[model samples]
Target: MSTPAPHAAPLVLVTGASGYIGGRLVPALLDAGFRVRAMARHADRLQDRPWRDRVEVVEADVQDPASLEAALDGVDVAYYLIHAMGGGRSFADRDRQGARSFADASARAGVGRIVYLGGIHPDGEELSTHMASRKEVGDILLAGAVPAVVLRAAVILGSGSASFEIMRHLAERLPVMIAPQWLRNRIQPIAVRDVLHYLVGAARLDGAPNRTFDVGGPDVLTFAELLQAYARAAGLPQRRILTVPVLTPRLASHWIGLVTPVPTGIARPLVESLIHESVAAEADLRALIPAPEGGLTSVDRAIELALARVRELDVATAWHSATPAGAPSSPLPEDPEWSGGIVRGDERQRPVDASPETLWAVLEGIGGRRGWYSWRLGWISRGLMDRLVGGPGLRRGRRHPDKLAVGDALDWWRVERLERGRLLRLRAEMRVPGQAWLELGVQEADDGGSILHQRAIYHPHGLLGDLYWWAVWPFHEIVFGGMQRNIARAAEAAPPDSRRAVNTDTDTDTDTEETA
Candidate 1:
């Protein structure tokens, strides 16, 4: 018998590869024997993905027609997952323009098909800006020369999804709630896994016509019932929801922003979409593509899977996966004078009687339940203030207690860069007047020991930012100074066998969940 010869796999271009859905879809496409080209506006944003090296990455913005044309070249299928919700008030216009550019470019590139994931909305009813834009984008794609499959979904339930995050935080933080009347509006929520399954399956629908298909889970329930279901799945007490006719969508979004990591800009659109019922009107997609192995996921099962991922620290992507458009992305300059801005820093260094490996171990395990090395009360106070102002605060916590990768959220700080056993740089997600970063590094010393270096870097925005830095500088001695000293002391005090034990436990400790 002759062995079959391998052939080139069909190439699929995934825009918005840095987002929650696109990030997870890349690995799924690869598993399904498709060649994936992960496209992002900034290619470096995808550098830290676990499958970064597996897929070909292209830097392209959908609004930039030239870049889209180049990115869509030689693509059998293109996934339109990009949206401009974080771009401010003109987001709908931007979404419209981007869809037009992408549709034209895909046709010029001779792409086989286009797959789009859009929000499920009722027909013949006035839609929110978010849902209307989604529907328009789908329409633009379906009208193009290339065949398109638009899978419309309601609330996508997953650990790191925005909808799931909003629901989780509301249920966890509020035992009794004064909510909007939209809580009674019916919705057919779908699991993120099911959405991804349908998306991947769309690629193989060779002769399917270009049209929209409604996709949803096995259960249909109201927002109130969903919250109650989430509480039950998370092992929490029953929640009392008091719906008031006075609470408007804008007010509800602000309330959500204050409690969850999601901000008002993104939350408002989501809130508006929930003002009406969003039950799926048709299940035509299931006829073309079969459901996953066990059939559609139930609401309870989806919540369980999401909670399990959070507990196990195995979330693949988060709503925060994409950096905010206005947030600082530049690296810390070597010299403050060269930055062309006022840069204030709190720097501390300490010599330790421990190996570099031991110091790295302590540094990697700094946040989450382990807590900051010093000034716990001060940190808590600041975190609470941030939360009140619609910030991530400290509740987001580190993804893993013992190990961290770049982009992992660590108590309102994001891991910006990681050089194994050498350097770890964290960018702040907390609400502040300006941008901030905390960098921790370890190096070998001449005395057969390690030297720990810690720095808190801040770039002020205006007069207020500068004043804020000066106000906080007085406490740096207790905060930054003690943090460095305590970290060094921890490395020195740790047992010689603890370094290996930490690494081993990262793989074996799947059941132990860390608290804020």
Candidate 2:
């Protein structure tokens, strides 16, 4: 493949662009005045991102050499943020293979630099499978022909980070608990903002050698102390934690899986990594790349900022953004009728005594603290069931109270499509036997009012999926029917001024009323 024409700014390729770090890094690189090309296995996943229009998006998989080579073409720097943490027992081997492919592709493309984010591990000690895999990937990149910068960090504290979410839920849910012995292991956590700072700076380095750099925040604390700090930041009472020796990482992972929204597959590796101290061994990188403005974020301040972002409904990217619920090739509801397999749906339309704008406002603000505008008990029961089965459940919540962007998480649903004042389509993230979506729309009626349309679409996998659909088919009335009625009622009752204030822009709107 031929290289694309160069821009005034250096072109940067960000692999895993839909992932937490990659998603956040793209905008940061753009803000730093670099032309960015975002690569993902499914380019459609990047379509909904707010920065989708600004960056060049290419569908590429690291495991595919040709795809990697094509993606790295015309790239000055490439950020390798891909990982296979939850891909079962062969994850490490897969990681190694992908890293090797990426390295070879970068060298062939003549990419100047490759920046990789890896976990921090104690030197000369046996590391957990997770940490070992990270180190191996870093080693592969550094040993390659291209100059690479490997940044090793531990416990990235952010609103939607896996580590932060695990800590947050544990601190909030269990005031008194029997914890694992590793809770007392010392760790040097860094804020996601600082990690981004160093990442952006690494791209501009004049002649940095290919080496691994340990990056961490100022404070060093044990996991127990970190939990206490989290409790303090969240205004919770001091937690009573009793450490016991019998609880192994495997056992603790199951316990954490039940307590937090993080699944056992991803939690096991994290729990194992916590068994070792992860304090930075050196600060050599500081001499090359300067610290962020002010200084390295303190632990307390990091926790506070993360909590504030959650409360204010301003989380930029979530841990699950990288792994969207359904398959990318799955046919959308809007696709041609003859496109996909056995599809089932529950469709409802109601003429409302409200304007299209009023109905749209109610539709936009359906999830999060506003509730589902339907059977409250049923929604809660279903969310709980989903949680028990290791799904996101309803805890993910919406990013904003009044307005939603396309990729925003609304409870167990992801905002797949959004048309301001017209339609909102949500894809189910809750664990189910089949792929599903919920769509809400507003249309002007002939009688100077509005018409509300609601749909629940599901695409079954096999006999099990078909059976699952029929089993829940009986409750459609109580769930879907009630939702339709309640949403129309909410639109009719909304204040006139409140209906006019619905803004679809991603900016925080101070004028909008805080919906409950």
Candidate 3:
């Protein structure tokens, strides 16, 4: 079965709708004319998705079978993208049990087809706990009466994808590396675009039930080659990777956790999977879905596109958003006046020629992918320094590029306060010696324009913290001064306040503030 026979959009239910693949998949399915129901345990987290309004969101937990009935009711096809990768050491058992419950419930609901995304099996080699669990879950789905369609793939290349993030950090941070042995092992990788094509195409197939197909990009390369390719795509010099057998998977996983944002639980399984070759033995997936317009994406091309998306801050959803456990609430409660300590500060106030509404719009759109609206090189340097010291750096971009929620993580800062079109306060989370905050205030001026108030407040911990603040004072003026001026200019250059059309980058801003 190649092309799906024509029919009205099926009532499709996608579990783990907030995950990296699932979050991106929802839009693709909608474009293909399918009516989609996105199911996630925490429905609030999915509110930032660009397509959030397009799909129907239902709250469901795999562990609690009772909650899945509504999602399964009247569903024609279900996408089982949920897994326990981040649920700690007991993930395997939980994944297996969850699969059984889902399968049984699907049967009871009279669901027609189950489309599962699983990893390609290692040829005649032992599997890691996560990989083995994936295999077992697929079997569990097929064991039920429903016709299950499984599409197995290896490393998925896309912005905010875990595998690409690991490779990205390795390539960007390390100029030369003492690489693990797995770097020499060969593996097949696939582009997310192609993977979605197959998943959506599978649903249209008139009758390809109970089938398993292998999917991968056209290229088959080693882990070393993949890392080097990413570096080249990012315009860096070809990296030096010296393979060392002494670095075991455990050591490598911990090292990855340090250099990159990937947690030990998720990185460990991926590293363990790298222990075995993951080349797709079968290429029957092409028959099911026609190749993309440009054909399959080569490794270098895939990495290029993925990084471009990151730079543009156009990522749809992140792997971390898959499970929001222990995440800090956005728009944290305001602190007292003496909060982080106002021992010393840099204050800049400018009267913008634009309306208050226009100025605030520019202020609200700061950070995330927009950079600092001033010196990006300095911001990148600070982020890199933070990463080296085991901080989040700027990896966790805003959940939505154009929107900011109360609890959203914005680059190396957290949204401490958001007052819609009036003000935004961001508290620093980088490895600073003490507490710090950046506040932007906009209010209508008596002259019918707007006054922009910018302040940087810091509370030093001790001698070291005080010294750290003064040490960066000279650099701070350059960054902060340029920031206030540029923001004012952007607002001035944009259309009138009522239109809300503003330039994020404009060169005509003039500084009307007294330098302090």
Candidate 4:
């Protein structure tokens, strides 16, 4: 039997167009031959993307129903991807109100259908505040005049996803962790790529409306198992993880904030939601779409893809530095606190069983060969833009493998100074509104381990530099954090080449003593 393709692509209006999932979805829609009208609070935020010109950018908030009439005017389908993840304390109430307002306006606009992505909740189990609120929003959307297609998914594993970031941070920061009881909860994590497929598949779905599909990856594993797998793929040591019943969600959220860049405002609700085992109950989605292509990606392959993408971002910006590496080349002076200026510094020490030489190998291997931590396409496109503005674009790779010297070019950075197994500095060559530097220093532990210090510094020119610095902060967080963890993981996974040197020294000492 042959199925006919749909006549014309619908003009799809996507809310939450500036978000992580929304960012990916809008482009996918465009590539699939749909005419997209994206709505965001600010259009300037959408300017960096390549598709900015291809689609109509309407500046409107979902909460403001009056503003949505224009946005929804000519749209055949609407996708509601907005959530109040960063809203403090009462985000659930805010999310519900916003969804209701949007639903009312969308229905009045005579939209044919509404597609929403919600969280997966077990049938009879108690749902967390986040999951419950997600359900509430879906219910409200379905009550409208238009048909709503709801797709519920578990933890979405991707580069910029909140849940993925939280887990990545915990795995990197804590070597021996005392986790909450929720850590043992089973979860079916779907890749962001897979989730996009289901969302896009629903756009012209034949006859399903006002129906909910519980979607997840094929594999179901406990949170502990996921964490360990992430650690292994990232090259982190096999950590001793213990789950204690004492730590409440609130306390765990605070702990997460301390260890990772996730703020309390966002992590709290997410942590509260961690109590549920969010595996899919129905397998019907597989029947709708074929099996293998729509299934979950293996844990190792997913992490590798993510890491490689991030590295590509960094290398694409080669010769186009963000912050200068190391101390100032001239006598301008350096900012002490992390102000809006370019260079930023953060320090944390972990007890590891590795030598300084092993750690340096990981550092030198960063640029050229190593991938950026997250959002490779975003990095490459931006890097190309930077290069087009007469900045360096992707030509600079390191001079040698596993070796660096002062003033050596590692991508856009010139190695300012190199102390073997101790310190490394890079100076920026990119034409920014200000200057930048990236400095990494190490201290050998008394127990034959090492302390890793990674810092990024930028001296902004004025207002524009400050704006540029803050604008890229989210990306900086993802890229820098991933780099630090990769270094630690690489060091732990490989044995130091100097161990043989140490053994030879011991043998010589014994021979000299016997001769005497």
The per-prediction CA RMSD against the true structure, in angstroms, equals: 4.6, 4.6, 8.1, 16.2
Note the Cα lDDT for every prediction shown.
0.83, 0.83, 0.78, 0.67
Model 1, runs deviating above 4 Å: 1-6, 334-339, 500-516
The residue ranges of model 3 lying beyond 4 angstroms of the native Cα positions read: 1-7, 324-394, 399-402, 405-516
| Window of ten residues with lowest summed lDDT in model 3 | 507-516
Q: Give per-residue CA lDDT, model 3, range 2-71, as digits (tens).
A: 2334785687889988777887889999998998999987676566567888888999988889998988
Q: Candidate 4, residue 212: CA error in Å? A: 1.2
1-516 per-residue lDDT for model 4 (tens digits): 112247756788898776667778888899889989988765654654557899999988776778988888867789998776644457788788888888888878888789999998877777777778889999999888888988998877766466766777688778999999888898888877788888888787776478788888767888888888888988989877999999998788767755553445457777877788888888787777664453568666666655555434321111111122122344223634543434444344454456887776666655544433334556556555554443433334443434554444555466665676777777676557787777777778888888888877677778888888888877765667755665676677666643211111111110000000
For model 4, the stretches where C-alpha displacement exceeds 4 angstroms are 1-8, 291-295, 314-516
Model 2 C-alpha lDDT per residue in residues 186-287, reported as the tens digit of each score: 999999999999999999998857999999999999999999999999899999999998999888887887777676667888999999999999998899
Candidate 1 lDDT tens digits, 1-516: 112136778899999898889999999999999999999887866787889999999999887899887788888889999877655677878888899999999988889899999998999999987889889999999998888999899999998888998898889889999998889999999999999999999999959579999999999999999999999999999999999899988888888877776677678888998998989999988888999999999999999999998878788887777665445666775555445788889888889999898889989987766677777778877877876766666666655667777656777788888897999999997878988999999999998889999989998889999999999989999989878877877787788625631322112111112421
TM-score of each: 0.89, 0.89, 0.71, 0.61
Candidate order by decreasing TM-score: 1, 2, 3, 4
Q: Residue 25 of candidate 1: its Cα lDDT?
A: 96
Worst 10 residues of 1 by lDDT: 503-512
lDDT of 1 at 73: 80
